[model samples]
Target: MDLVNSFLNFVVPPASLLMLAFSWPTLSFINVCEWIYDTYFREIDMDNKVAVITGASSGIGEQIAYEYAKRGANLVLVARRDTRLRGIAENARRLGSRNVLIMAADVVKEDDCRRFITEAINFYGRVDHLVNTASLGHTFFFEEATDPSVFPILLDINFWGNIYPTYVALPYLRQTKGRIVVNASVENWLPLPRMSLYAAAKAALINFYETLRFEVKDNVGITIATHGWIGTEMARGRFMVEEGAEMQWKEEREVHVTGGPVEEFAKLIVDGACRGNAYVKYPSWYDVFFVFRVFAPNILYWTLQMLSTNHVVRRTSYIGTGRPLYLEGSPPRKFLTAGPSTQVPVQQQLKME
Candidate 1:
């Protein structure tokens, strides 16, 4: 066994490289052909189709609802905040959605997920698209967690939240030959700072859907989107903080958000789902870092560590002096005031840290 293992290990790396080298051009050409087909020849007509979106109260989910609305899709918006959902539903109607239904439910709970999916079926008769956008983010470093017991909220919301709805709606989706759109994140693979739990949950979510896609085959379409930061509440620091941990204003906003506007990202997501694209990436440039993470992981790690250390040193919120320290021009509040609706210039919004 040891001799066989040694021989295979010695041969596999060069063999894999040779295969990739020979296949690269063919793969690229095939991808381009697929892109052209998806772009021009294919489109799932969403007119009057029932589309259920979890986490539709705000952020990318809200924008996605509008995109679907423009295509005349009937919308079922689900969220915990009823008041916010009402406002979103109104805007979705104004955007051209023929019929909009709002449901207030927690995505993490199986009962809530089942109830919403059932109600959506009863109302619309069939679900054409099940968009899972319910996710929770955390800002504090994993080691800084004072109460580790609260950590499961991140996984529960970010991972199981998406899974529950997908499970409950899969049968109806299969009946309609519908699609499942997942709003995953680039952190699924990127080893970003202060997002240990969130990253792990997203990684699990991505892997689960990838496996499910194979099992379901062409019966149910799945579009998994992985993008970087947008101008969402999460980007504004409305993340899950560890209990007993102080909320500090970190000027690391730029470090976290380096993607395009949520509106643009949402448009692309809906279009890709309608076209049955397997993956959708916003800003697209983030794809470059995957190569770094794969071929030069040490370099990626060192660079990330350096960036995190620099931000930590310049953190303006609290410096362990017992009391909070607010630097000049920094807000004292824990959460930033940038709402998801606040539009910034596209060029400035896409600027990297």
Candidate 2:
């Protein structure tokens, strides 16, 4: 496509080719939307449909909850903080959602998972959708990181986190032929050097959801979003950045990765979920890279290492802070309090809740 786009760019203007490419995708999407409304939504109803979402307290999860609620989805928002969960539930109710049940259970617990899903079934009597967007993403060089021992902990949240929910919800999903949207990260493809843990966990999620779609093909539909970075709390919280690591958010002289706005990204996610898509990728550029990383590993990784901030950069101080490249202050979320939940630390809150 790049080569074709280049040839067209030389003949006409690059802008013209971009416009042509953009026009076709929009029309194709409309066709899919029509098919979905006819096959599922019109046949059923979403006015008070039920959706169970993990990691609903902040970042992408919160936005997804907002997007679904806007469409009248009765949400079961799961996260660990009682305060944050309650705040999100209230805001969702105000957003025109008919019912919003707040479940302050940390999905990391198996018992919590079974109970949460059971209650969701009893409360709304059906689950129309399930979105798994939770993960613990502290990464470092496998050897240098003391957190190497933390892999099981991360997996418990990232992998088992979605597993138990799917298990309990599956019987219901099979009944309703509900949709499942699992949030996998872009690193599932472009594995960054020091971001080993995050990449591995996300990769596992990708494989699980991909296979899951086929497993439940006759019943529920599945969509795996290999998301790129977005402007969310995960992006804002800088503590996770390792000292001297070359992150995408670093200065021009430093290494860094580019990202998209959170709401915009979340909107695309909702659109795909509504349509029951199989895969959803963003910034749209990474689609080709995902393929390249598979077929041309050597050249792709070598060249990307230069353009991307995947560690191995010249040594520097570990001082972490990024001057707001965009604007300061959180954007207004109508009736929404957007940030990490502070009612309790994730570990303690999950257990308490």
Candidate 3:
């Protein structure tokens, strides 16, 4: 490996320069033509379409339900919180949707994911789009981790959570030549401090879908949505510790919120998914930073270091005070809540009333 690296070090730079010189114009032209094609030919119709959305209880997911509802699409909303899901479904109906189904399921569980997708198909008859918008975020430095063992929760929820739903819904989606929209984050490709595991999961998500896109080869459309900061429940819900290794989750409090509105972000995401866009970067400005990440990594690293300082309030456990409990492989922690809840199948949390 060392010898291969040494050889590449000697040859890659010149070869890259030559390749860039020869391919730049062709690549630029192709990009221009692709943009034109997408702009003029791409069309997305939401009326009467059956759409399945995970993480539909709150944040961008909740707003996405409303946006799709406004377009007259039938929706199946999934989340761990049945109460919140019910509320969002009601709002979606008021927005314009004639039919809305709320299914409480954890995306990380294969069976739960299967049930969610199966229930959606059973209700709608055909599925036009499956939106994977479920994710979790943390803001602690790696060194302060009390139990690095608990880090897998991050990957399981963010990466595997997206994958499980896509896997189960693929067959139904293929029937309609349907689309899959994944809510990845800009942190996947960019340098961001204190979010190492979250970024890794997102990066994995991006790579997985990118590869899946070619494997499906026009059979199923895949749209990867990459977003930066947004004003949402996750933004204001911060974490704090009482003492050594004992983690305490804090209440949602606004402490310098920065980002675009979740509602607008949701609209853009829906529009992009329906248009079959390969990628969507929110706030538009994230594109510039993404470019800098590739070409000017050092500068990007320094900037992110500065940006992460605000999160370094104190040293606390990585997993938090909540004892890591995977109830039948599902974490005991409440979904999107700092407080813990009793063991129950997430799918049964719904109340039709």
Best by TM-score: 1
In model 2, residue pairs whose N, Cα or C atoms come closer than 3 Å (at least 3 residues apart or on different chains), thus clashing, are 247-256, 248-256, 248-257
Q: Give all candidates' CA lDDT scores.
A: 0.77, 0.67, 0.75
Quote each prediction's TM-score.
0.82, 0.71, 0.78
- Scored against the true structure, residue 341 in model 2 reaches a CA lDDT of 29
- Of the two candidates 1 and 3, the one with more favorable lDDT, higher being better, is 1
Name the better of 1 and 2 by TM-score: 1
Model 2 lDDT per residue over 16-69, tens place: 556767898898899688767745664334578898999888778888899888
- Quote the lDDT for 66 in model 3: 91
Clashes (backbone N, CA, C under 3 Å), per candidate, total: 0, 3, 1
Per-residue lDDT over 1-353 for candidate 3, one digit per residue giving the tens place of the 0 to 100 score: 99999999888867876787899899989978977887779868889999999988778888899989999999999987788788788899999999999997888889999997888878889999999988877766666555554477677878998999999999998999999999988888886666777888889999999999999999999998888778776674432222222221222334556667888888888888877888887866777776567555789888877876865554332343233222122344443212354533221110000
lDDT, candidate 3, at 163 = 95
How much lDDT does candidate 2 score?
0.67
Please provide, for model 1 over 315-339, each residue's C-alpha lDDT reduced to its tens digit, 9 standing for 90 to 100: 2211121222222233533322212
By summed lDDT, the worst window of 10 consecutive residues in model 1 runs over 344-353
Q: What's the distance in Å from true for residue 248, model 3?
A: 14
In terms of lDDT, the poorest run of 10 residues in model 2 is 344-353
Instruction: Report how far residue 170 has shifted in candidate 2, in Å.
Output: 0.4
**What lDDT score is found at residue 327 in candidate 3?**
17
